[model samples]
Target: MKIKNLIPGLLVLFSPLALAHPGHGGDHGFESGILHPLTGVDHLSVMISVGILAALFGGRSRWQMPLSFIALMIVGGILGVSGLVIPGVELYIALSVVVMGLLLWRSVQISHQWVTVLVMAFAVFHGMAHGAEMPFNSHALAYFSGFVLSTFLLHLSGIAIGSAVLRFSASGRLVKALGAVVAMLGGSFLLS
Candidate 1:
């Protein structure tokens, strides 16, 4: 069958992701934490887009941006675990995907300072989501560490993909298209 024929099936696979976070009754640990981000399309998109943006910016932003995000994310997680509520965390998390996708699509360049600020802004929400949903019986440190590691890996993957894509002569269009699809996903979720 052609690729077009498989689109509907693939879209169905992603339907449950609209909820973003669902509770778990049993104990969860490092493994569960690691899988949390991967299982949710919202988390995956922003994490990867951050990496792509880092790659696009190059130089100091390559490390500085990701570090800033991770640091702020940890703080967000702490806030979440402490029951300090940030109103509209879920809406903002979904919005992150749309914002990031637009940046990627347009290939916009902002100052390193602005990049750090924007990235950290969204990072908090992601961390909060992970924090708020943490299993009741899980080891806090291990679970947090698992998510941290997972976020790092996802960023790394985005960097690699972005770098590789940039090397190609037709990369701009491909990247732009990717951004559109990502934005659409976030948009659909918001509208739904």
Candidate 2:
């Protein structure tokens, strides 16, 4: 089968597993945490969108935005593990995907600082989600390490895709199309 055809099937197979509760009579460890981000389409989409946006911006933003996101996400994660609540975290997480996809679609240009701030703001929700869902039985440090690594890898993948798109003269429209799809998926999450 073609890779494109196979891709959807793989995602379908893994998605349910990803969304399953990690600590509810299930094994919990570094592996479980690593899989957490992959299970949620919303998380995956938003993280990838961050990468794409960063790559599209280039320069300082390419590094700063992702770094800011990572740092802030860690803070948010700490808040979550500490039982601190941030209202509307789920809503904001979905919104982040929508906003990031729109930004990518428009190829929006803004200052690096502003972009970093935007990324950081959205990251808090994602981090909090990760923290809140962490299994109590899991090794906390290992779980955190696993998720952090997974998130970083996803961002890198998005950056790679974005870089390739930028390199091709005819790929701008393709990138925009992807952004539209991501936005639509994010909207679906809001509805569900």
The numbered model that scores best in TM-score is 1
Can you give the TM-score per candidate against the true fold? 0.89, 0.84
Candidate 1 all-Cα RMSD = 2.4
- Per-residue lDDT tens digits for candidate 1, residues 1-192, read 999999998677557554555643236878778887887788888899888888877888888878888888888888777778599898898898888888788764557677679899999988888888888788889888988999999999888888877888354887888789889878866765
lDDT of 2 by residue, 1-192 (tens): 689999887566445454344553335868867888887788888888888888888987787777788888888888888888588888898888888777778775556567678789998888988888888788878878888898899889888888888888354897789889888767766665
Worst 10 residues of 1 by lDDT: 17-26
The whole-model lDDT of each prediction reads 0.81, 0.79
Residue-pair clashes per candidate, as listed? 0, 1
